[model samples]
Target: MVKQKSLTNDNTTKVEFNNSVQTIDKSICDDVNDTVIANGMHLRHTMLTLNSFRFTTQLLRSLLMGFILLTSLNTKQLAQSSNLFNRNTRPSIECLKNDRFYRDPNRPVHKIWTNIECSKYFLCLDGDVFEFKCSEGLLFDVVRQICDFKQNVDNCDITADDAVNFENFDLYTQILFSPNNRNPNGCPIKGTFFVSHQYTNYQFVQKLWNDGHEISVHSVTHRGPEIWWSKNATIEDWFDEMVGQANILNRFANIRMEDIRGMRVPFLRIGWNRQFLMMKEFGFVYDASMVAPFSNPPLWPYTLDFKMPHTCTGQNCPSRSYPGIWEIVINQLEVGDFTCGMIDSCPSQLNGDDVYRMLSHNFKRHYLSNRAPFGLYFHATWFNNNNYLEAFLRFMDDLQKLSDVYFVTQQQVIQWMRRPKITPHLNTFDPWGCKPRQWESPEVACSIPNTCKLRSRVLQQDRYLYTCNECPTQYPWIRNEFGLD
Candidate 1:
């Protein structure tokens, strides 16, 4: 006689014949045809009449084959679905070859290009391909080459659900220049200069500060092998590089230490936590070395209280929190197809009209959207190009026509961010308004600026020191910032 065991709650079926029991897990055979289950039942019933062992063996083998076949088919379907998804997401090798930045050979080869969606990017390593996706609400920034806020990624179609809706906000523009070498030509047409001590004209720096343009530190040496700042620089190295320049500025330029509130690292290569720790330890309020992604509603200058909202494309970006020190992001400007971190690096082939259009297009991206501060970072050499200079002037002239657009300094931008006000209140904004220049000492204009030729401790070479104040005994390099021989 044959008897059927009750199915367990787990959906396991048991069939018994002549003191032998065979268990079939319905979970495995759930997708198997109903005929397969019915045939098994019929074999068990026939066992009662025929009482044969061979028939029962055949029934178990047939059921096992069905489970294997169904599992194989399901696995094949899943593989096809996975392949389809990869085909859609992965960028073609041809696409990478065509990318101007990718083909340049100057950029890092590993993270060369982004997929069309901008939500993911491809990594090429040793003939193998790997893919990475940004976190939720972020997109790949092709310019800065990092995962950034959705609004900051150009060509990214991803919608930011949590984006702050800024309405009727006035546009504030900040122009910053990091002048590494000294020239008789004082300030450029517009913008503040973050002067390095190497070849800087202290008198000219003082004049710029007095003229109400911001004077921030670049570095004492501004030494090259630019990668050193991001890779090998220790906390002490940053202090000497930045604070050393501040000392020189204060002693020679007569600019107060307290007034030198900002700095831009040489080559925009940040030293991650070491850099920020140095800034926080000292009194520096901001650093403008970090680059923001190119987006319509651009990223605003932000403090380091929380984890960075954008990707750290600077390589060794800070992992820990730095509460008060602000990051004045170098929001990139979009040119024809590519983007540039600094205005000068944009297409030099562009005519005056092309330059104007490029500037206007990038400016409107900020003006029409969240009104984050539009930054035009440049070096003094950029203005040497007549085309760029003319176009830039035209662009600024057009911007001046707008009642709401205000050209402020980096310090003023931070102040506004601290106590934000609407467009109506901007005209009367105290921070944006200039304060009277309170000189600590009588202004001493060296009729004949003292030009001292001193031997550099680090470079071990004769360096020219130009300043309104008395020249140092030795060339002020990194470690010997005071130039005390």
Candidate 2:
């Protein structure tokens, strides 16, 4: 029988056949047939071993190629991951350029800067400098450069702007009540009272504050020749009256000093330059003494950077600019076709029906036009009469009946003016409109099982008309004070 041996070279396998005595042919069929016949198992074993080695060599080659490809992939993944980490961990840069351009280097922030031209302001918010554009119809007043009513801007076509769509907007209303009267017995009165040295019902003011009603300063001493609020008063005089009033409210009414953001001139007569300067210095955000809406459609609240908009009907409107201080103009109440700011200034005394018509008409003006804020400006004396009181109540109830109508405070109105929510995208704006509030119950304030005798009377002392009343003094309802016998 022949014996066979296998040899391996660097790249190939070779098979040799031989006998015990002499070499034979390399073909297994010729030289190894005897071995296959005599020792079949050995021949079978050699053949099987050769086949297994060949298969194993092919598998190892495949595995080596796979390992090289996997290593290349892992290195690329590591490099890509390093780049991603660097991008996410890098420092942010804030660049403040030019006099009008600024960037906050430590954080992502935007800022507004005033330019040398009063009418042209620059905003550096989105890493770019851009001029502010007013809403349709308004023009930039060069004196102060803020968007203002067209009447104040010379050579501008007021008629060229597109009208605001009321269908897409919500009606915003604010009631401005100047606490000019003091309660006689340190109790909240039901009717009209002026700020006197006699007494202040801190409880009433507290209720107003808690109920979301804005209580603004008229004057600490609301006593008037009406001339004190004219241009004749100095800045010191205006400060003593306006700021003094705020101090009194904060001290006595538990109202935050910063919360009092609005004021009205005594008798609706502005102290002009001095009053505005004092307001800016005293942290007051807006003033409600101006009466320009009588001649034009109501305008949104604007800063006093330019001349007063509309006709400066009140005495000595400020000629100088008070930047950043807002003028909350009193949009006139419409009585039939005529328009007036003061409730009493209407042609004649309005009954409940006239009052309702007047208010509804005035509201339509704002609801129809640019959707400017609607104001119901009045002294407590006007509401003292049952005719006006019931009418005012009806007006308020009617307002509450309408959808998307909010009877908010003046400060709230100013906030909306600054950031208008007129777009259809803001369908949920002013969510607090007529929401039920936890106010003191009428029975608690007025009726307490005969322990308190609620009475109201109209008393005229000198030229002023006021309503006087007596109550339990603990929980008194100022409105119900006069209605009771």
Candidate 3:
């Protein structure tokens, strides 16, 4: 047996062997039979042997030529099949050597990102680029470079069946409130607060904690040039912001440090892989700062195993996988008639009615979609406006009337996603409704007294000084740093 090698159109070389053992046996048998018959007879066998030998020789030659032609045809067929397979099955960008460019030629090589929508691939071979489209209804996703459905492009390893369970009959809503500045009264009028250190009043934060509202850290400074600051911040910086915030609350506010489970970047500017690594190291469960408009029904809480399907709208988005760290994406909001991702960026001049309409529209987007948890992500600034405040309060009141809706925290929503169960009714879900709890101090007196004002001479002070307005007259027990009576 002899092996033959052939190159296919796809630039792959395949090895084949000549399988003509039967042909060779038949040729040898015919020659031996002709020789034996010639030996049995003398005179007549001599001439007959000559004719027989000639016929046998010609037959062997013909068989040899036929086998050669057969081998050639088989080689050609194998090559053709290889080419067909290469063409029909989409090859990833990896098939093309040094091919960094996507479909667009204008964008820089580094800037062009692959998504689930990639259906075609350009093979850069031999100093020429050849384009190959994926087989019908599939797109060539740049991240993975394989042809897949648009919905499956995120590469989260989620199945279509995982999108929604009609039998479940429930949906979720989570509030991720970024408290950019502290409230003077220390009590959040609405939603959970991501308190900044500048205005942090532990007593008020404790009230929020006791009320079952989530308390997440939003850096100490909540500094300017948000993206640059977050992107450049290190693990030490995050520790000071989050762990430090926890320490302040524990020492003064009496809030447990272990209770803080999540965090959001100050400006939704992801700190890339480093931030997630920091979260995983510090025992944090999730981060809700990511914006994912590319996701259709919005992505559920997924670990950092594969490339996220959503567009990385914010700076320094995570590029590598960080196991066990979950991302609670910020779904875009549907403003009155227009859709916007950020609440602050929603169409301006929206009165209370328009705000209510926008919230309703956004609520439906999640309700009708995969039932992924909807997020009401906003800063406290939005609530400062009377119209916006009234509209939000009204919306919540209206939302509570609906049986399926749940206004929970990010941590609570993620808990359900991890251990999901189908129920006949929405109320059956745990953490759906709240029960009353005892407060350390009465709600009316949650804030410090009017006579005692918060004063901090330095920026890095851990606790605020409760300075007596009328010196020794008010708060007679309190003393200054110098211990003056």
Leading candidate by lDDT: 1
Please give the lDDT score for candidate 1.
0.61
lDDT of 2 by residue, 359-435 (tens): 77788889788778777665444654667767776766666555556545677766666677754423344422334
- Rank order by lDDT, top first? 1, 3, 2
> For each predicted model, how many residue pairs clash, with residues at least 3 apart or on different chains?
0, 13, 5
Clash list (residue pairs), candidate 1: none
Task: Please tell me which model should have the higher lDDT, number 1 or number 2.
Answer: 1
Which parts of model 3 have CA positions greater than 4 angstroms off?
1-191, 336-339, 423-429, 433-485
Best by TM-score, which number? 1
Task: Compare candidates 1 and 3 on TM-score and give the better one.
Answer: 1
Model 3 misses residue 300 by how many Å? 2.3
lDDT of candidate 2 at residue 149, scale 0 to 100: 44
Candidate 2: where is the Cα deviation over 4 Å? 1-198, 336-338, 423-485
Q: lDDT of each model, Cα atoms only?
A: 0.61, 0.47, 0.50
- Candidate 2 lDDT score at position 213: 56
Model 3's alpha-carbon lDDT is 0.50
RMSD of 2: 33.2
Worst 10 residues of 2 by lDDT: 160-169
lDDT of 3 by residue, 70-109 (tens): 2212233322221111222224333334433234232233
